[model samples]
Target: MRVLTGVMLCVLLGALDQTVVIPAVPAIAADLNGFGHLSWIVTAYLLTSVSCTPIYGKLSDIYGRRALLLPAIVLFVAASGLCGMAQDLGQLIVFRALQGMGGGGLMAMAQASIADVIAPRERGRYQAYLSGMWGIASVAGPVLGGLLVDHLSWRWIFWINLPLGIAALILSNRALRNLTVHRREVRIDYPGAVLMAGCVTASLLVMSWGGSSYPWASVQILGLSAVALGLLVALVAQERRSIEPLLPPRLFGHSVFTSAVSIAFLASAAMLGATFLLPLYFQLAHGVDAATSGTLLVPFLLASVAGAYASGQAARRFGRLKYVVLTGLAVATTGFALLTLLAASAGPVAIAALMVLMGAGLGTCMPSSLVIGQNAAERRDIGTATGALLLLRAMGGAFGSALAGAVLALSFGAALTQAGHAAGIDPGLLRTGFRAGFLACTVVSAAGLLVALLMRDLPLRSGN
Candidate 1:
C-alpha cells in the first residue's frame, strides 16, 4: 500500500504537469515578453518527455527502478523550483524540458514498479488506481491552474508541485529501497538511444507543424518526415545487432504485445480527440463559460474511473481481457457516433450521458491493454514493454489533438461561409462543424474496435 501510494503520487504529479502549465502560458508569455515563442514552452516539454520515456524504461530494467526513479523525482522537483523562479520564457522552456526529462520516468517507473510487485492477473486492480489518479488530475489540473493564475500568480502552478513532489520523493525512496535488482554487465545502447530520440523528435515536430505552422507538403515537413523515417530504420537496425537493445525486437514477435500497443494507440487517439473537441462544443455551441464546461465534463471523468474499477474486477473474475476490451471499444465507437449526431438543441443531460458512455468505454480499454502488454512480455522486458505502449499512446494523443484541431478549423470555416452572415453564433454552422469533428473521432474509435477484435484471448499470468 505504501509503495502504491508513493507511485500514485508520482503519477498524479506527472499527470498534473501536462495540463497545469496550459493556463499559465499566456501569463508567462506576457511576463517574459515572449509571445512569439510562447508555444515552445509546452512543445519543449512534450518533445523531451515523449522522446525520453522509452529510454527511461529500458534504463530502469537494467539499473533497477529505485536507482533511476529516485534521481528522476529529485530532478523533477528541482526543475519545478527552477520553473517557478524563471524570469523569462526562455529559461522556463529550458527548465520545463528538464522537468519533462524527469516526468518521462514517473509513469513508466510507476507502472513498471507495479508489475514488479504484483502478478499480471492482480495488476489490473492496482492499475485502476493509477487510472483514477489520471482521471482526477485531468479535471483538476486546468481548474487549479486557472485558479492559481487568477488568485495568486502563474508561478504558483510550478511552486505547487514542490510540496507534493518532495513528499512523494521521500515516500518512494523509502518504499522502493528494498526492491530486488537485476543488475547486468551490459553496456547502455547510446547509439540506439540517440537514433530513437531523433526519430521521436522529428516525428512529433512533423505532427505539430503539419497543417498548422506549415503546409503538409512543405519542404520543412517533408524533410523532417524523411529524417524521422531514416532514424527509425537506423534505430531498428542498430537494435537488432546490439547486445542490449533499447527496445528488443523480440517483443514485437508476440502478437499480444503488438495488438495491445495498436489498441492503446487507437484508443488514445479517439479519447483525446473527443476530450479536446467536447469542450469547444459546450462552449461555442451551448454557450457556457470555461469553468462550467469543465464542470460539465465531471460525468465523463467520473464514469471513466467507475468503468476502470469495474473492468479491473471483471478482468480478475474472468481471467481474460479480450472481451472486456472489445466491449469497451464497441461502446466507445457508439458514443462517438452518437456525438456526431449532436445538434444545437442537444441539452446538457444528453451531452453528459454520451460523455459517460465514451468515458466508460475508454476506461475499460486503457488498463486492460496495459495488462495484456505486460503479461505478454518476459519479466526482464516488462519495463520496456510498458514504456513502448505508453510512448505510442502519447504520440497517438498528440496526433489526435492535431487532427481534431485541423478538422475543426477547416470545418468551422466552411460552415461559417455557408451560413452566409447569420448573426450571433450560427447554430447550424456550429452543429455542422462539431459533427464533422465528432465524425472523425468516431472513425478513430471504430478503428480501435477493429483492432480490439483482432486481439487474442491470453490467460492472465498468476505469477509475475
Candidate 2:
C-alpha cells in the first residue's frame, strides 16, 4: 500500500504536468509573447525529459530506484517552483527544461517500481489501476488548469504541483527505503550520452525549423539535417564500443523490444496529436473560453480512464493484448476520422462522442504496450527498456505537435482564405485552425492502426 501510494504520487506528478499544460498553453503564450515559440514550451520540456531517461535509467540500475527516485522528485519540485517564478518566456522555457530533467525519471521509475512489487500476471491489474489514475489525472489536469488560468492565475498551475510533489517526496522516502542496491563497477558512458543528446537535439531542431522557420530545401535546414544524421551515426558507433553503453545496442535485437518501442512511439503520436488539437476545437471552433473548452474535453479524458482500468483487468484475464491493443488503435483511428465529419458540422454532442471514442482507444493501447515491453525486457535492463519506450513516445509527441502546428499554419490559411479573411485572421492563430489540425490528426491516427496490427502476442498473464 505504501509503495503504491508513493508510486501513484510520482505518476500523478508527471501526468498532471503533461495534461494541465495543454489547456494552459494559450494563457502562457498570451502573457509571455511566446506566439512564435509556443511549440517550444512543449518541446523544451520533452527534449530534456527524454534526453535524461537513459542517464537516470542507468543510474537506477547501478545505484537503485529509491536513491535516484527521491532526488528526481526533488529536482521536479524545485523546477516547478522556478517555473511559477519565471518572468519571461526564455526563463520559463529553461525552467521547464529543468522540469523535464526530473520528468525523465518519474514515469520510468514509477513503472519500474510497480514491476518490482507485482509479479508478471498480477501486474496487469495493478497497471490498470495506475493507468486509470493516469487517465483521471489527465482529465482533471486540463479542466483544472483551464479554470485556474481563467479565474485565478496561470502561476497556480505550477503552484499546484508543489504540494503533490512534496507528498511524493515524503512517501518515496518511506516506501522506497527497501529498494537499495550496491552500485555497479561499470564506468558511465559519458561520450555516448553526449553524442546521443546532440543527435536528438539537432534532429529535433531540423524537424522543428524545416518547412516552418526556414524552407525545407534551405541551406540552414539541410545543414542541420546533415549534422543530425552524422551525429546519429557517431552515436551508434560510440554506443557499440562503450564499456557501458548509455543505450545498450543489444536490447534492440529483440523483436518484441523493437516492436514495442515502435508501437509506443506511433501510438503516442496519435494520442498526443488528438490531445494537442482537441482544445483548439473547443476554443476556436466552438468559440469557447479555456475553462469551457476543458469542460468539453471531459468526455474523452474521463472515458479514457475507464478504458485503461477496464483494459488492465481484461489483459489480466485473457492475456490477449494484441487484439485489445489493435482494437484500440482501430477505434482511435475511427474517432479521428469521425472528427473530420464532426468538425465540419456543428454539434457538441458529436464532438464529445468522438473524443470519448479516441480516449477509450488510447487507454486500451498504452498500458498493454508498456506491459508487453516490460515482459520482454531482462530484469536488470528494465530501466533501459522503459527509457527506450519513453524516449520514443516523447519524440513521437514532438513530431505530432510540430507536424500539427505546421499543418495548422498551412491549412488554417487556406480555410480563412476561402472565407475571405486570409489577411483578417492572424496566421498565428493555430488555435482556431482546429479543423485542419484535427484532419491531420485523423491521418496520423490511421497510421497507428497499421502499427497496432503488427504487435505480436505476448504470453497472457491470468492471475491479476
RMSD, every candidate, angstroms: 2.0, 3.7
Model 2 scores a TM of 0.87
Clashing pairs in 1: none
lDDT for each residue of candidate 2 in 335-414, tens digit (9 for 90 to 100): 87777665767487877888888889877767777777777777778777777777777778777877776777665745
Off by over 4 Å in 2: 19-40, 146-153, 180-183, 207-218, 283-286, 341-343, 414-440, 460-464
Global fold similarity of model 1 (TM-score): 0.96
TM-score of each: 0.96, 0.87
Cα lDDT computed for each candidate against the true fold: 0.88, 0.78
User: How would you encode candidate 1's per-residue C-alpha lDDT over 275-388 as one tens digit per residue?
Assistant: 888877788887787778788888888888887887788888888899999989888889888878765566778878899999999888888889999999999998899889
